[model samples]
Target: MKTTAKILNGLLILFLLVSCEKDELESTDPNLLNSANSEASENFNNGMIKSYSSDVVIQWNELLSQSIDNRLPQPAEVKIYVMVTLAMHDALNNVVPKYETYALDNSEVDASDITKKNIHTIADAAVSKAARDMMAQVFPPSTATADALLNSILSNIEDSDLKTRGIAIGQEATAAILQKRSGDFPLAFAGYPLYTEPGEYRSDFMPWAMANPPVWPANAVYAPNLGSLTPFGIESGDQFRDQAPFPLNSADYIKDYNEVKMLGCTSCPARTEEQTEIGAFYIENTSSFNNRVARALIVQKKLDGWEAARLIGLIEMSQMDSYIASFDGKYHFNLWRPITAVRLGDSDGIDETTGDASWTPTFTTPPTPEYPSTHSYNGGAAAAVFRAYFNTDHCDLDLISPYNLPGTTRHLSSFSQMARDNALSRIYIGYHFRNAIVVGERQGGELGKYVFENNLREIKKLK
Candidate 1:
């Protein structure tokens, strides 16, 4: 009797572990649940059905570029990505059962009657309404333009009971998310005090080298305090901050200095024609490029609307967290950009380190202090999310840059390759050290893991 009781207890413990392990699991099986609605899900995944969420994202990408072109800062751009995607995911999650919604609590939104609704009609109305509404709030100046575009899209959807119900679901999701993010205004920390230290970022614009271009005469627009913004899944901004960059006079610093000097200079002899092109290809802003990549890959893989929505939402949330974490490292370490470091190299008292008084990067440096490159971090987070959602690193896909490289379409063998190229682009363009790229990639990958493990996982149906 004692032995039998012990056996039963052990089995109970094992069952609990298996059931609760969803948080740590990276991949979701397509057939994880077998329900009476299995055929509908299969249809959605196999491209027999259209995906409304995918359409909304592709269209929003265009408007997002316009906002950035009008000089929306990087942090603001990323926030735009997060809210729209989150709203879309929450809106459609009522009819689907795979992942948990981000801002909308299940108890708050009634999904009881939604199970019987057509996934296509529901996803269409919900994704469209949520995206249209969020854009109006985030980009007020473009609200009129956005509303017209949204109405044009909606006019195509025929009137039906399903459409009415779908629109309501979307509106509910929008209200919930908007209420949750109301305090997350972009200017929340606009006038926060800027930090400065021995090697920290400063606004003094002095020429580095005689041959280099003149210092940007205008005052630098200080990056907003992105570190304080609310994260979708992570507890705090500093949760994933990377360690500080290598010390100023270390050998590690010297090696990093020499490599960028040879390959990243405005007139670098070591940078090949193709390397320059790669750098320019990723010149598209962080939020826009990654979102474009995800959309392209989704079409290539033929994933349905719901699957595409989840993947995009997951990727954007991971990236937003990455940006916050990267900013924490940037402001915390207060490191110098390569342009500053290379120009001031002589003063550092390192015998091997030489200063190029005329040194300039291929492009102007961003205003923020440098440690981990934001572009690399975004790419790393994007790659991690794509790999986890697809359950493989080896996704054969072609990425056609919106920036029109010599060949618009760059064929890729895997998501990791795309990430590798994105990191190397910073070095090729002469803005970052190799260490920054490597560390940023690692930081992003870890953040991706945290997002997947902690948020959004397939749960058992209410069977």
Candidate 2:
């Protein structure tokens, strides 16, 4: 009886996929798999592929930005982005075999039955379904929006059989990734221990927290358990952890201390106007900014669907692992932010340093351990992936700051230059010492290179 029921259920699903009209299936259940509106034409080309993939990625990224703006944990944001991209890549790959998949196995998605003529149309449907399902699963609040987006895309695909098969493949990819990442939620924040010793991290009073009591709680450390979360591509979170931050009373510490103290202050005379602008420009949410840059490059470079999927998958996965590695080192070292260090400089018994209780940073310091700057780390990882993917660091790219100075734009000539600017921004903003930025960028670069070389390689076709 159980075997008969299972077979009947399978037949019912097949019937829905093959026989039911698109509107009928959608009306039968609003929860059914749907499509997003893509600007892709039937003619396959780099530009068309960009239209197909970029629309899905960019929309989801907007959702991610909204979540971040609403104060979702950083780790959770990265995890969701990684999952969605991976699902999209795997689903597309399943339809049109190109690169090896990140999560889905060969047996799970057979593409031998798909003909070359129908590949692009079918792949677009698969990618849309995969992205929608993964986003809805990982970030539940975006379900309605995701569904609407999917419906818009699916409504445009006229072929019912192709769309149905694509949806099935996408659903299979989503199920694989969901199962792979089970139990991988960001751990609850149970509050970190307070330390009073010099060079140790301590939570500071946040005026913003007072302004919004519910979202920004007083003295809250941001995602202390982030390091413990599972990485998407890397072996483990600590695989690329940096060494401990500079010790107090050391020359390196003294040099970094004085640099930030003189320049990071809101009223510091040593800081130039350009430095201030640079600091403010890069202060937007890192993930959002990086994704925008990547998407622009994807369009500019004229990447096909396979290429775009691999590039984005690499960037997101590398950044995710970089965050994990940086967070691991952050909690392990438990170093104080520059604000804390400057306020209690003299207490560290370092004669070269002077305490300034009235010191204020140009920006509110992030509530996390300062060692191995996560922002710089993500920048380095992202730059590394870009450089590797393009086979060079040079590119004509322009980006606008999303926060601090919203309309300000910066043109960059190379990926490495952007990474360097990101590292320096941490110092100019007075959030991190120079040592942390340096080490963080280095660690991130290593992790990014590792992820690119190791994961999602192009499949070698036999003659």
Candidate 3:
């Protein structure tokens, strides 16, 4: 009897240990899955204005902006997108109309080894179903423009392609979008930035740049901070700029300022002396990234389509807010870019080491005042939000290019690493000082932390 009792106790202990290990390997680990469950009330704008296989998924989101510009209301944009994303992702997972992509509650813990080669194939069919259903909601031929546009937008799809199926589903989504809108054209375009033709620059841009010069600290030295109360406030721009590596009112700034104004418009291009290498990188690299996104959107399955659209929009919004904060901080500090300081090291009144001129950066320098990097802040902020979805220290995304650039590639280990790379690229390419990027990373992280801590909590409450 004593022997039997001991055996039973040992069996129970063994069972508990196995259960714990399984949970750890599966999802009991917060680091492996999403923990954000807070509800949100923000009328999901979908994007401030920003993929298929993750390429078709991209083009699909681009269409969102185009569709809205053509007359779709903000509410219509949100509804149509949400309906389609939800419907298609649902179909992909073999679920019904309302339960696609799993709710915040249903989000699963995907193991480290999860990779879907045929992910786009399944997403295509799901989106098609949603498109057809949504089109039924709109009242006119005009309402289904996205469907027509999509047909023309796609090229590589074969008869067996799921994307072709999504076009039909898109028709339904389009119609549904039209049904919900009241047809207020001007109001639809109300808050969008006023255009001054393709070539003309905004009148207010230069003024905004010139007037918002950064303010310097009283000492302008590298001593421990003077402990001013103003730093704690929300005011942006000047305070951050003063600490930047670039010197204000110097020739280096004039060169950068000129480039910012031209971005993609100037025939001269950034490669030439007139083009501050920054413009060259933007015109070159960013364009490639954008096109890649378009292709992904044009090809993804409906479920992935929804995920792609929602993610693209969400990231853009998050980035915009991040930029707003970083820019405000930069100008507030009255800092300079690294190039300016290193060039005139003696005048900087600091003991920091400066690098040689003629140093090329790994990435392009963006045209803006220095201190916190806009790219770093934006990149880091986007990464923070995405971390919840792909819970990994890094991603080895086999760097496939759908735009026919088969040879070009990169390996991203984590969202944070990607952000770090982006920030460092600026330095490698000689666009910013390392300090500016560090600050940008810090600020970007803080903004993202705020999203998870405050904004997401409010938004997820809705979830």
lDDT tens per residue, model 2, 36-148: 22112123333334444455555555655565432555566667778888898898778765667887875354554555556656877888899889878878888888888
User: Compared with the true structure, what per-residue lDDT tens digits does model 3 show for residues 185-262?
Assistant: 211111112223311112222212222213222212111111121211123323333344444345554444333322
lDDT score, residue 124, model 3?
52
Which whole-number lDDT from 0 to 100 does residue 436 have in model 1?
Answer: 92
Residue 161 lDDT in model 3?
Answer: 45
lDDT values for all models: 0.73, 0.78, 0.41
Give me candidate 1's TM-score against the actual structure: 0.80
Whichever of 2 and 3 has more lDDT, that candidate is 2
Off by over 4 Å in 2: 1-71, 107-109, 204-219, 461-463
Residue 462 in candidate 2 has what lDDT?
Answer: 17
lDDT per residue (tens digit) for residues 85-200 in model 1: 88877877764545688877654444434433355566677777887788787777768776776677678778888788878877878899889887874542222233344355
416 Cα displacement, candidate 3 (Å): 2.5
User: lDDT of model 1 at residue 95?
Assistant: 45
Candidate 1 vs 2: which has more lDDT: 2
